[model samples]
Target: MHYVCLTTSDPFLSLRQVRIYREKATGQVYAIKKLKKLEMLLRGQVEHVKAERNLLAMVDNNCIDKLYCLFKDEEYLYLITEYLPGGDMMTLLIRKDTLTEDEASFYIGETVLAIKSIHKHNYIHRYIDVILII
Candidate 1:
């Protein structure tokens, strides 16, 4: 795997953000969730991140963020994943209230398919919240 040191002011991620450079020269982007100090303080969150990584690694779904790589340093853990251009679903819904039936159906169907795929792999999405947008 190729690695490079990132500078401080990349707009792609906020402070303490971990990132994965695109494999090609097209200037694409992917998100790398970093282990936060607060999360380390909470045992549950730490365990959850581990479980999420383990589960994410086992499944393959377009709706789900793809876990491409993992890295660790003295202070933080990084999980590289595919970037979902359309942010979270709840955020979108909050911005626009009351979607048409067709739109709602489409999203719901997609969510169901994702859930089904996860289940087929013997994993459960315990936190099925609206915040998860493909």
Candidate 2:
């Protein structure tokens, strides 16, 4: 908490997100996701969570969202990543309803590159719905 200052937070995402922040020292913006440990445990997603964290730490590609750090207290796990003001592709798609061919190509090409990057690391991305625009 002392390392960063919390900025805007979405109440809608509060269930699984601590939301946006601005680093105290660098003034860099980041999105910090907070996952409830108890919910993860009850849903048997602990292994998946660990695997995700491990994969993020190992992977390094421009197309991939860099996981800067992760830490946990007794209740929650936090994932800090670069903030994209453009938000996720899923949300954008819903908001736009339709996109020009050029726009589609750009996003799709980026998404493909990101998935390919993950494949290069020997791990398939099971969730492709939340591709962030960066």
Candidate 3:
């Protein structure tokens, strides 16, 4: 539970802001997603948040990010997940503009596998943004 924040700003686009942290106990790194409770209530995303937690718990695959834990304060709900040091796909695409055929195929294959796994769990991903891919 002892973790140190590694960033002062959000690293990606989403309904919540993500901050990187490193656990002092094991020196393991993770991403902490901080979602404002007020925003969720206003957007009627309360159920979505719960569903996300449930779905994430059920998912177990290398292609999909894994959630490690969840916690909440009075203002924000936090989701702790395994950290991927490699930046998101959007950042990669922005820097490289395009990928070679092999690289593109690899990414596409991973995405397909992730999608199939999610479907198997009876959850359809509503967001397919590059930022969602790590």
| Candidate that would win on TM-score | 3
| Consecutive 10-residue window with the lowest summed lDDT within model 1 | 6-15
Off by over 4 Å in 3: 8-14, 129-134
Per residue, candidate 1 scores C-alpha lDDT tens digits across 1-134 of: 44443322233323246454554455557676777646565645666666778877887777777787888887788888776656557666877777899888988888888888778877776665322454
TM for every model, in the order presented, reads 0.73, 0.82, 0.87
Cα lDDT over the full model 3: 0.78
Winner by lDDT: 3
For model 2, the stretches where C-alpha displacement exceeds 4 angstroms are 1-15
Candidate 2 lDDT over 1-134, as tens digits, reads: 44565565543433476578787777788878789999888878888778778777887766556788988899999999766566677668889999899988988888878787778888875655345654
14-112, model 3: which lDDT tens digit per residue? 569988899999999888889999989988999888878887788887756688899999999998887766666777788889899988998888788
Worst window of 10 by summed lDDT in candidate 2: 6-15
Which candidate order results from sorting by TM-score in descending order? 3, 2, 1
Comparing candidate 1 with candidate 2, which one achieves the higher TM-score?
2
Q: Please give the range of 10 consecutive residues that has the lowest summed lDDT in model 3.
A: 125-134
lDDT of each: 0.66, 0.73, 0.78
CA lDDT of 40 in candidate 3?
91
